[model samples]
Target chain A: MPKIATREAYGKALVALGEENPDVVVLDADLAKSTKTIEFKKRFPHRFFDLGVAEANMIGTAAGLATAGKIPFCSTFAVFATGRCYDQIRQSVAYPGLPVTIAASHAGITVGEDGASHQAVEDMALMRVLPNMTVFVPADAVETAGAVRAAAEAGGPVYIRLGRSGVPVLHGDDFEFVPGRAVEMRRGLDATIIACGLMVAQALEAVEQLAAEGIEVGVLNVHTLKPLDVQAIVDAAQRTGAIVTAEEHSIIGGLGSAVAETLAEHYPVPMLRVGLRDVFGESGRPDELLQKYGLTADAIVDAVQSLL
Target chain B: MDTEGVVAELAEKARVIRRHIIEMLGEAGSGHPGGSLSAADIVTALYFKEMRLDPTRPDWPDRDRFVLSKGHAAPVLYAALAERGYFPTEELATLRKLGSRLQGHPDMKKLPGVEISTGSLGQGLSVANGMALAARLDGRDYRVYALLGDGEIQEGQVWEAAMAAAYYALENLAVFIDYNGLQIDGPVNEVLAPEPVPEKWRAFGWHVVEIDGHDFRQILAALAEGRHTRGQPTAIVARTVKGKGVSFMENRVDWHGVAPKGDQIVQALKELA
Candidate 1:
């Protein structure tokens, strides 16, 4: 079992994409090392830009690059990429449908002791509402690389949420990524647990624990938040009588709300949204933060057990 | 190209653009006629004489890029694109209508020639700076041009972009400040005076060029000088009247975003002719 950080996957994928496509350009707001784009910067200095501590300007520049037929991949902390530069992304990139891939690393509480200010719990909500913007929360390092490749070929504005810490490499090299589609990791008739990002691994763990206790749990990894896999959601709702959604984002207006919205209109079920409560985070270790925020595998197990 | 001939042609085009502005605003029943009319000459010179673009290929890779940072004045950009053959000239009358490509604010997806969708002031300049730097990194020969309203320069982001552009030495970027001295509220001096604007840009390390907004020759020469400029970006501060051709509308802040009435539209058009 090999371990790879999602940020490293982004760097590797960026270099590969740059090699394959001349239009692929990378921009960083002086976080090339933190965001893991330093590798690409070293290899292709002509195709890389260091925009200093100006995230808003970086986003706008990425939009301009897109307008000039250059596919720009901007890397930075998730908080700065989404929170600090929302307007820039909204008007310049998302509004115009520019093919700019905002590779947001250090997403969620897994950003560790850097604390609450660095953790971006609302990036998904902020990006998903904009028209023509695609939001992708890849489950692990392998999937992060796949999502990066998919976004480059998608030909539109995309937000790829990644984490700073090393996560298990669940998806193999051959695992294909299709935008707006969900991947079912397991099949069970009892109930479904929809998850994304770091929580996907926890949900799988919960499913394994639940299986031993004679409770079958269906686990589906939902990567793309906008243009959600509505059909898969309906199918899961029909097959399973209950649903539990887990993510590293805020429970409000995120993966949980997106799932609830889909089910409320079509198939109503006993749904439990497993995510952070309506509160900002503080300084804590990654594992401690996940436990304090109730974003652990044990929490998923408890949530699924309660539905029974 | 002969600079005089280009300026004369652009001057004539500006007249047609003013006529189009009044007609479009009257048809839409509402629009920013003052700023739009003021910006007509600058946009006309860019599309007709400065930019290397094919109307049929709106997304040409190496074509010079133009962004309307002060996006509320889309009529001027629309007029330029319409004259440049981006879409049918007849569609100009349908400005701001439901389902019309020409939106009240520029929408890059709907409109053919729009580079970025902008309406919120003080943001387009940063986007332009990004485009300019991207071109430099790619070693592309194309340049980027952005139009900013003097009133809109109050945004902090504008200065941030100014500093960044100069620091990056983005000489391939050219910015035009339509110094109309009037915003929607009233005279810009009374509202938020942005005087010593050229000095501010120069302090930020830009190659500042002050010129007559309506003088096509000055506009062309300034653009040429901006190209020859090295080690920093250039800002052409063009002094312009709010509503140049229409006697009643000129220098009137009230006309900043107001459409002309039935008789007034005809009068404005006649003056433009």
Candidate 2:
């Protein structure tokens, strides 16, 4: 499978979206190149706005454009896009149910070299708690493109978290995406491994490794974290009787927390979370950081084995 | 647009809006009256004399937009919308009550005429800039007006939008700094003043205008000047008293967010009368 960063696919999808709908406008807070809104800017300069390193104003402006019947896509690093402008998103976008797409890239510990300051490990928690916000953490480039389309069609605020590192494409080009529904990648009787974003690909590796070890485990790719596919999770919990959740975010508030909350309320199961513990990421290569933070396929296998 | 009869009509409308502010705050038992009262004339001019609007078609795409960036003063906006016939005048009593469309802040989804929801300061200018940019993008002729509080500029996002508005050369956008000179903590100047406001907006490439916010002719002329100016958004710095109409509450910081009580409401209504 080819490898492509989700941010790359986001930039391409935005260009295609702009071509399809004239009402689809893109705004960037001076990260046009890194966040990949630069391609959209090149294609539709008239519809593109550079808010110049001002994430709060960019978010508020996106809400304004949404109010005027425009589907505005705002892009920046996850740290600035969410943490820097959380109140702006809450008041101006989510409060009014504006159709503003906040496509934040460089999420998780994988935002290498920038260290803890630039990475956003709690963005999903921040967005999921909002009343009108829909959160999406796509697994790969194909899913990233589909998530962008779904967010554009959605009527309210959406936070699509993308990554900086290139990830293995786990799905085919013709893969169909239905938002808020989990895709069961593999079947197993022992336990279910649920994951989102780039961690899904890593979990696939864990599934294969567990299968080779005379153990069986299922993998559920949960892309939509806000309107979670709770039925799929409950069914997986029933079918497997144990659960392991993995993500490239904080173990405290990201996918692990969401899945834990769901399973605890509906169907309780022995679970192990694999992500960053209550700590911060330092400047390092993406692979080294993943290894150090226990966010790799090996970590998922360890978590599932621990549950057993 | 500022004929003698029209000015007289707007002045009366401002007085009526002020009365509604007092009455609504009195009923709600806890809502902002000072800023709402301070902005009565400017909001009155926009609703009655300046901005183009149709009461029945609140969703008219071509209609001009009014974003109350200083959303704490929502009573003034609700009063203007009601007086403009967007809703029944009697609904003013339901300002902050449960099940009412009028929220404590101007919620665009709940209200018909509200262009965007805002309570957090410093974001309205950005939203207004977005609206203005959208107008240019769609080739629409509608103008976007945003009213920002004097202290709201402290949020830092206001200057960011100020710079972007000028960068985009948004001629159809006009923002008003409701320089009422008072905030909750105390006088705005005494507590982290965003003073030299007009000069700041000017430095950020806005066409600057100063006026007594309570003056009808000055308010109208500034609106006209903004419309006549080209290639940049206009910043109208209106010097205003915090509690403009009520004698005892006027310039009093205590009234900034407090609702008028029994005797206070009666006195405020009498002074307006």
Return the number of clashes found in candidate 1. Answer: 1
Model 1 lDDT per residue over A86-189, tens place:
88888888888889999999998889899989999999999989988999999888888889999998899999998998888888778888888999999878
lDDT of each: 0.90, 0.92
Q: What is the interface RMSD of candidate 2, in Å?
A: 0.7
- Which residue pairs of candidate 2 clash? none
Candidate 2 global TM-score = 0.99
Give each candidate's fraction of reference contacts reproduced: 0.69, 0.90
Cα deviation of A272 in candidate 1 (Å)?
A: 0.6
Q: Find the candidate with the highest TM-score and give its number.
A: 2
Off by over 4 Å in 1: B1-7, B137-139
The CAPRI classification for model 1 reads as medium
Q: What is the number of backbone collisions in each predicted candidate, taken in the order shown?
A: 1, 0
Pairs of residues clashing in candidate 1:
A61-B130
